[model samples]
Target chain A: MITSIIINGILIGLIYALLAIGLTVIFGVMRIINMFHGEAVMLGMYAAFVLFDKFGISPYISVFLTAPIFFVLGSIIYKFLIDPIPAREREITSLIITLGISFIFATSAMYIWSADYRTVTLPFSQDVMVFIKTRIGYPALISSCMSAVMIVGFYLFMSKTYMGRAIRATELDKDTASVMGVNVKWISIATFGIGVVLAAMAGGILSPIFYIYPFVGSNFVIKAFTIVVLGGMGSVTGALVGGIILGVAEALASTFLEYSMKDIMAFILFLGILLFKPSGILGGRTRL
Target chain B: MFFKILSSVLFLLLLFSQVSYGAGTFKIGCPAPMTGPGANFGEKFKKAYTMAADEINAKGGVNGTKLELVFEDTQAKPALAVSSAKKLISSDNVIALLGGWSSGVAFAVAPVALDNKTPYLLEHPALDDITRKNNDYVFRLQPTTGMYSAALEDFILKVVYPKEKKKQLTVAYIYVDNAFGQGVAKYGIIPFFKKNKDKFNLVVSESYNENAMDYKPLLLKVKNAAPDIVVLTSYLTDGILLAKQIKEVGLQAKMFTGTGAGHSMQDIYEKSGKATEKYFSSGPWHGEIKDANWKKWRSAWEKKYKYVPGEHEVEGYVAIQVLAEALKGVKSSDVVKQREELKASLKALNMKTIFGTVKFDNFDGYTNQNKAYKMTAVAQWINGKLLQVWPKEAAEREPAY
Candidate 1:
């Protein structure tokens, strides 16, 4: 029982890692918290639903559709909403603006889709593997694998590409990067877009397994933020660690205590980390 | 510009209300969650009752005066429900009202209707608290949390207990920690077993935040108790997620039971497929019933909706049917006279509906509460379809555990 719980915890941890990574990536480069990231994920879930409901497209196929559209949408959001505010007011402005965007996203989804819970039940939803008498669900396995691929792919993108180095430079110091001839504005916008793509991908991967609705994103956003903070600001690896820790903690807590009490434990752990290790697990590194 | 459009809409509503009040129409002020979180539910409610009312209107109006349903958007919020109730009472001058989806909204709006002595029949909101307050003017046609639990108990005694080959009658509750869920715990399943201590043993009781993503740990706790039955109380998404997780964790008890409403959704069988096989649940309405009227309505509804009407939406249709039957009995359009006549009609109402028979019993101080011989439809998921399997007379097939 404990082993299965641990495995389930780690599996969910990987998905949380993916979402936290997206939030961290945006914060890594732009230093502006994309409060609408959850909304972006919510859109991804709905996108999958529409494709599945109307066009008979699977979420696996819908991810391809969601990615490019979300990329363009994210870019537009950054260009118009995030960039227009002066840098001096950028942080607060973007926060409030993204909150509005989030509200619009949720309310619009509520209006258009209605508040009915939707799920894309695939063939592999219940197909499972047993190891040491522990059940491993296919949905969780496939989603965890997708998260891994995306994380590794992101790492490769950051280390190898010229544009990636420019983004890294902006992360290190924006003004200094501007002095070094890097287009910091373009880097921020691109990072925001990429961040949304990551969140959307997470949404697509989980759409088959998790229940989808208008307020679905709100469920993950707080946890995503908690993971980002637990991992430390701008620490890519921190997201992975923070997410795993949080997931495992929730799993063990729920096993021992009530399910609601598990949240209390997670929040307590969050507070403990903040009180003692404010720098985070791998904070101040500023690495992608 | 927004205000102009808003006011224009308001003006139209006001003008319509004023024009309808001119002798030839009977205004009914109702609250629906047409524009908020409860919009889908509200939409379903509006459709069901409107279909019932429209059918009556098409047949040449209810006693010469056309029934003008003035539906105000409550959005299932308590404040909105109260305001809308007030607006419907004062501005619309509706003698009777309906709608108020959530239990809290129903409870909140009930007092406003009671204060004005308007007949406010709650369509589906069911909390023990709503009826326990003893408001004579406020009436409920929906199943209470306790009733749902009792219905589950009925299934256990009728189906599981009779069929069990071994000595295993252990039960557990893995429900959401909300008013509806807790009410089910407090006034619902717990009380029945408390009386039937020899019949069943309550092994585990677990609660969680409704939106909590992880249900595995909770399932593990339920598994530890080694319960024969696991009862869940949750909303649609939570119900679906928990049921999925229950299967994913591979916890197989003798039977998995759902308290009601949230568990009775068609999407559960649709989404989970074979996972929900043999899952027992109780609902306010099941498409399969032993009545010609219900059968006709079901066929008509399915012909139009492309699916069977769920229990959640059917309550609205039933409430209105009872209300309509009561109004039709009264023969008066005058507010004071209609109100008096409506009360007498409702008090003596013995009409049949697509949902069930309508007869409010004020037994045990539950003033004007809808009563029935078999208020619950105990159903089991069989091959992705809910088959009514209890109340032997209503049973399509024997309940299989």
Candidate 2:
């Protein structure tokens, strides 16, 4: 029973990490806290649902298509919505702007999709593979593995590539990076696009496990924010670790204690981590 | 010149009388969540109201005075429902109010309807307190949550879970924390747990917010508890989400019953895919009602909507049809006069509804009428089709899974 909980916790944690990575990147590089991050995820799910419903595209393939489309969408949002705010007032102004964007996106989504719950069914939707008397969902395996790959790919992209170095430099010191001929505008757009792409990728994978509704983003935003805080704000690795911690805590709480206690567990972990580590498990002094 | 003056005066008097009599248009206001999380129920109410009003109009307009329906979109918010009710009464000049889906929205509009001295013919709001404490102005067409819970409990006890072999009786309850969920918990689930304490063990009980997307934690907890039955008292979106998760987790529960008749929708089956076939729920109305009148109504409604009348649509239609019968029986268009006559007629009514006979007992133009609230045939998804499963007399097919 304990082994199963741990495995389930790890799987759920990995998925949360994947979901939170894009939000963290957007915050770290662009310094814009996107309130619409979850909406981007929901939109990706809807994209997959439309594909499956209309053309019978496999969810796995839909993920690849959705990610790039959402990347461009994120770039467009950054250009139009976030670019207008002055740099000095970007902190407060960006919140309202992104909030406005979130509401607009959510409303437009409702108008287009009609707020109905949609889902994609894969061959493994209900298939359970038992390993040594422990049962795991087949799609859950796909979600976790995909999340891990994305996290690693994200780290490598940030560390090795030229654009990646620019993003990291900007995260470290925006003024310095801009002075070093970084074309900070493009970097911001690229970072925002990557963040949105990650969100979309998570959505595509997670939608099969969770139902798709226009308002689904509302719940995710809360968890994603909690995860960001728990992981240490502005830290990519922190967000990933925070995601896993929260997921595992939730699984454990629901397993031993009451399921209702999971929310309380999240808050407690957030506070405990803040008070004790001050920086998250993998988080450094730099803002995530 | 004197003859001309007399003719002019007579014409003027006739015009004045016509204008005053024309004021008896009798507007019934429909305020529902036409756009929001709870919009499906609202849409059903809207369709049913339109069908009723159109039919009434064709039959010479509700006792010679037209039934003017003014629909206000409240978006399922309490503040909006209140504001919409005020506008409908004060600005739109509606004589009475009719439709609402959520109990919170209904409660918000109820006081407004009362303060304005207008009768509110509540179509589908099912909070117990709405009917229990009693105001004379609020008239609910559907049964309250308490009534539904009680009837459902009785049905389950007498029909589903017989006492002779009461083994494997454990329940896990998950619901949204709003009025709809609370009412089901307070009236339906809590009582069942209380009475059948020896027979049933409640392993898990949790409440989630309305727009909940991730139910994995909840599903995991329920599965760990090892329940033979899972009772979910949630509406549309969450209903499908939770069911999907349950299938994903592979909990081999004998019965998964939802409080509302949500599984009947094509959207649910379409989204849930094969997952829906294992789901069972109770709705107020079933298309396969064996009665001849019900069959006729079902055929016509199916042809028109491309879908059979669900519980909400059927109840909404029945509410209007009963109102029509009452108006016809009383032969009055006066708003105040019709209110009284309709109340009395509804209380004493045993009219055949589209689903079955609607007979209200102690139905005091107020609360807990019809003690005769039907069990509402149990329907299950069979090969993605929602088929009737209970009361073998009416059932078209055997219960699958």
Candidate 3:
């Protein structure tokens, strides 16, 4: 039982880490928390559901379809809604606009789907792997692996590519990047799009692992924010580490204490960490 | 010219009065969650209410007035329910109030009925206090948590354990931490445990929020405890999530049971696939009730709605039937007198309906709780279909596993 709890904790942590990476990247460049981050996750889940419902494609394959589509949707949203406002009004304006966008997305999904809770039983949904008499869900394990791959891939893209360099430059200092001919506007839009793509990827992988509802993304949004703060708001590695810590902590708490206390304990720990660090675990590191 | 103008004004007043009073259309206010988390059931209840109203109108309206069921969307919130109830009473000028899916929503609207002296008929809420508060107008049809728990204890002792021939019983009770879930689990299990401590041991009794997306940690605990039966009290989505997780976590038990929310739903059959086979959910209203009128009504409903009857559908149909019975025999067109008459009729009524005899008995501090032996049916999922398993007379097939 102890071994299983440990394994489940790590697996849950990895998935959470993937979800947080999106929020962290978006916040890193935009400096505006996308209130609709959860809605992006919902979109990914819904995309996977549609693929399965309409075309009989596995969510595993639908992740590829959803990521690109999410990229385009995210870019379109930023261009139409977030780009119109001046920098002075961007913070509060983006918050209100994205909140409205969030409602539009959720209410649209509800209207199209009629607020029904949807779940898909994949061929491997019930598959399990046994390790030291501890059974682990293979779907969950697959999701963790997928999340890890995405995080690493995201890290590489942000570090190695020319566009990645431009994005980081803009995130550091938009005026400086503009003086260096970085096309800061395009970088901002593309970075937001990439952040959304990453969120969709995480959502697609976790779709079969959880119930799909119009409001499902909101459940993960809070956790993602916690991970962003825990890992240091803009730090890639921090999000990963924070996610693992939070997930494992929740697993242990639920196992030892009351199950309902898992989330509460996580938030308490988050507040404690913020009370001391203020900036976050790696806030002073000065590097992603 | 003055006489002609005066005569025309008199005609206008008389016409308006006839339209308002002589129309013979009695409006009944109702609130259900039509757009929020409870929309699935609320829409189903709406359809049932419409069907019942149509049927009653077809069969020569109640005392020459067609019953008009005015449904308002509560969104399953207390504040919204209270607002809708107030609007339904004042704006709509409904003679009686009916319908609510949650206890909190029902309780929110209870005051409106009490203050206005309108007959409050509830279909989904099962909280004992909704009817127990000595409110003359409030009448509930759903079996209370206490009543449901009593049935569970009776079945567990008399039929389930003996039929399985288990020397001892260990039950893992996982329920949604809401008014309905906690009320029954807290009140039901304690008394049953005290009475039969030698026979049954409650290994796990935990409550989780309804929006809970994960159950692995809780299921892991249940696996370690290794209870004989895994009993869950949850709504639709969480029920499916928990059932699937139960299989994934490999929580082995003699049998799996649920408290008539998601486990008893058609969604479970469609969504959970084979994971739900042999699972049991206890509640009132089964598709296979075998009652003659129920069969006819179910057939008519399927033909009209092109789907099987959900719990909300069944309850809506019965509550309206009860309301129609209460509304019968009003000779005057006065809405206030009609409200008083309906309340009295509902209080004194002892008649058979699809849900058994519709009678509200004032007992044990409750002013108008139906004492006509509320039968709670235990429906078991077998090969993707749910059939009544407990109360052997109502069981279409024996429960497996």
Which prediction has the highest lDDT against the true structure?
A: 3
Docking class of 2: acceptable
DockQ, candidate no. 2? 0.34
Q: Which stretches of candidate 3 lie over 4 Å from their true place?
A: B1-24, B163-167, B329-337
lDDT (Cα, 0-100) at A156 in candidate 3: 86
Pick by TM-score: 1 or 2, better one: 1
Candidates 2 and 3 compared by DockQ, better number: 3
For model 3, residues B1-401, the per-residue Cα lDDT tens digits are 99999999999998898667535688988898887677777878888888899989999878777888778988889899999998988777788888788877887789888998888988778767788788988987767766665555666878778876777788888888777787667656556766787888888888886775567889999999989877788888788888888988898988787877677788877776568888877766453377889889888889988877756688788888888887875656777888898888888777687777767877887768876334577778887778877777777787674
Model 2 off-target regions past 4 Å?
A271-288, B1-25, B149-168, B201-221, B322-352, B355-372, B392-394, B397-401
Q: Is 1 or 3 the stronger prediction by DockQ? A: 3
Candidate 3 residue-wise lDDT, A1-288, digit = tens? 777887788888999999998889888888878988888988898898899989999888899977778989999999989998999999898989888898899889998987778876788888888877777777877888888888888788888999888888888899999999999888889988998888888888888888787777778888899988888887888888888888888888888999888878788879988899867788778657
Clashing pairs in 3: A231-A238
List the lowest-lDDT window of 10 residues for candidate 2 chain B: B363-372
Would candidate 1 be rated incorrect, acceptable, medium or high by CAPRI criteria? medium
| C-alpha-based local distance difference test score of model 3 | 0.81
Q: lDDT for every model? A: 0.79, 0.74, 0.81
For model 1 the local lDDT of residue B175 reads: 76
What TM-score would chain B receive for each of the candidates shown?
0.89, 0.85, 0.92
State candidate 3's TM-score: 0.93
* Candidate structures ordered by TM-score, highest first: 3, 1, 2
lDDT of 3 at B30: 80
